[model samples]
Target chain A: EAGVAQSPRYKIIEKRQSVAFWCNPISGHATLYWYQQILGQGPKLLIQFQNNGVVDDSQLPKDRFSAERLKGVDSTLKIQPAKLEDSAVYLCASSPAQSLHFGNGTRLTVT
Target chain B: AQSVAQPEDQVNVAEGNPLTVKCTYSVSGNPYLFWYVQYPNRGLQFLLKYITGDNLVKGSYGFEAEFNKSQTSFHLKKPSALVSDSALYFCAVRDGVNQGGKLIFGQGTELSVKP
Candidate 1:
């Protein structure tokens, strides 16, 4: 079986610029998640989706960040007016049950 | 709130020697623990998880973790280290009450296995 897929393995943008990352999870996987992994830190959950509805997004910066899993398949995460601090790798993962399977991730460099 | 701690920033070991990465967690109720490994520029890959049963949980890549409830610890271990095993390891935990399946992760520990 194929693993989770993501696009634009690497991205570079300037501060205040808008950027978006995409993810396509494993077929039939019910749970999808987006995480931010800053250097020297573990991945932090930014948002989670169960089917097309959001399960949790408490840590997401509503003012700057947004994500959607349309039709309960592929998903997208956007960070508008990006900040230098947002220069971290964005990871997309999915779970069939308890254990998670992650993609290669998109390395975003915001100037 | 649930939290996890990996006290060691890095650990160094020689080939054929044993290796360990320490982790501890705090939660209100029963906890579900997990271990993951990440190569440079790659996303985390699941190693093993402790839902219940025996304290020793073996995972992929010939790695294992021992869960000690009383100590609130789940330490990853490998009997013989390999240079190829050098990578970043993370420990995570999920609380029973929330059931949101949200995981709290540790800072991460870099394991360096020398040849």
Candidate 2:
């Protein structure tokens, strides 16, 4: 029973640069999610996917943030021209049932 | 709109003593409540969930939560705290009717168990 896997545990980029975070969900999981957690705050949902199709992304910033889950097993979240305010931890979670299992997350530091 | 509230920003308890972390939720119809713990630099781990049935639900790591429908509260408890129990605790809730079943999370409470 391996947990959800995320890549590049930490990332640092200058403002206006592009950064991307990748997530590989657990085996046989049908739902995947992306969340952003700022320091001292709880994680906020960015996007959610049920299989290869998106379920909800209303909170996502369409101007600069985009995400895709091509095969329904793995997903990527991309931020174009990242802003300083974007400095936060990006968490990837997967769920086979109602309960979610989270990954270690990627800490993004925007300079 | 569904929402969760963790009123305390931090809580401190001595090892071997009882510990309690407060949580409250608001949602239409029945609520699906959950508790999760997050260690420093790590992601959230599920501690417990209260969907239906018993008001008191036990979970991993000797943790338990009491769900009170009258008060609309779900508080995490431990009979004897350990230093290892220190972490950030989150309270979340989901509306029963939402198609995506997205959870609404509280701000999180930092629990410190001093040895």
Candidate 3:
């Protein structure tokens, strides 16, 4: 079985520039998630989608970040007016039940 | 609030020796614990999980985690560690109150198996 898939494994953008990351979860997986992993820390859940409907996004910074899962299969996370502090890896994961399978992640570098 | 904690920043063990990475959790209800491994520049790989019915859960790559309910801890363990086992280990938890199954992760522990 294929694992979760993400695009543009690495990204570089200037501060205040907008950027987007894409994720295509494992086949038949009903739950999708986006997480931000800063250096020296664990992955923090940014948002969660259960079949194209958002389940949780309390930790997400609404002022700058947004995500959507259209059709429940693929999702996109966007950061507008990116900040230097936003330089981190954006990881996408999918879960059928308890255990989650993750993609390689998009490492964003904001200069 | 649900949270997971990895008390140690790094754990070092020699090859062929036993290894342990400590983790503790806080939750208001029954806890669903998990362990994941991440190599450099890579995403996390599911190692094991403790939902119920098992205190000791064996997982991929000869790794295992023992969930101690009383202690509120789930520590990852490996017998006869290999150098290839070196990686960052994360402990995560989900609580019954959270219907979404969104995980709260620990800060992560770096494991180094020296050959």
Candidate 4:
């Protein structure tokens, strides 16, 4: 089976700009997750989705970070007014009830 | 809350020597432990996991981990290290107490194999 897919493998934008990353989870996986990985650190869960509905987003910065998993399949994470600190890798993962499979991720650089 | 810890920031070893990357975790309920390897510019690749039963689980590429419940540790081990094995290793956990399929990951341990 194919792994999770992510678009725009790399992106560079100025601060205060808006950027969006897209993810396509594995077929039939009910759970999808978005994670932010700053350099020299672990990946942090920004949001989680069960089907088309959100299950968790407590760590998400609601003011600027937003994510949607529409139609219970694909997801999109957007960061409006991207901050300098927002420069990191945006990872997408999906699970079939156990361990998650991850994508190559989009490396976002906010200048 | 559930969390994971990789005590060592990095581990250095020779190509033919044994290697171990330490990991410990905290969870409220039944603990599910996993190991993942990440190469530069690539996504994490699953290594092995401990769901239940065997304390020792074998995984891809001659990698294995021992789940020590008493010590609350799950450490990755390989008998003979390869230069190609150099990468970042992460420890992750999912707990029944946490709910859902959420996973908490460790900061990661960088492994370097010298020839």
Error of 4 at B9 (Å): 0.6
Q: Model 1, A67-91: lDDT tens per residue?
A: 9988999999999989999999999
lDDT of each: 0.94, 0.94, 0.94, 0.95
Off by over 4 Å in 1: none
lDDT of 4 by residue, A32-95 (tens): 9999999999999999999999998999999999999879999999999899999999999999
Pairs of colliding residues, candidate 3: none
Q: Alpha-carbon error at B35 in model 3, in Å?
A: 0.3
Tell me how far the alpha carbon of residue A77 in candidate 2 is from the true structure, in angstroms, after superposition: 0.2
Listed for each candidate, the true contacts retained, as a fraction, are 0.78, 0.63, 0.85, 0.71
For every candidate, what is the interface RMSD in angstroms?
A: 1.1, 1.2, 1.1, 1.0
Pairs in clash, predicted candidate 1: none
Model 1 Cα displacement at A59 (Å)? 0.5
Find the number of clashing residue pairs for candidate 2: 0
Q: Runs in model 4 with CA error above 4 Å?
A: none
* Per-model C-alpha RMSD: 0.8, 0.8, 0.9, 0.9
Q: Worst ten-residue run, lDDT, model 2 chain B?
A: B95-104
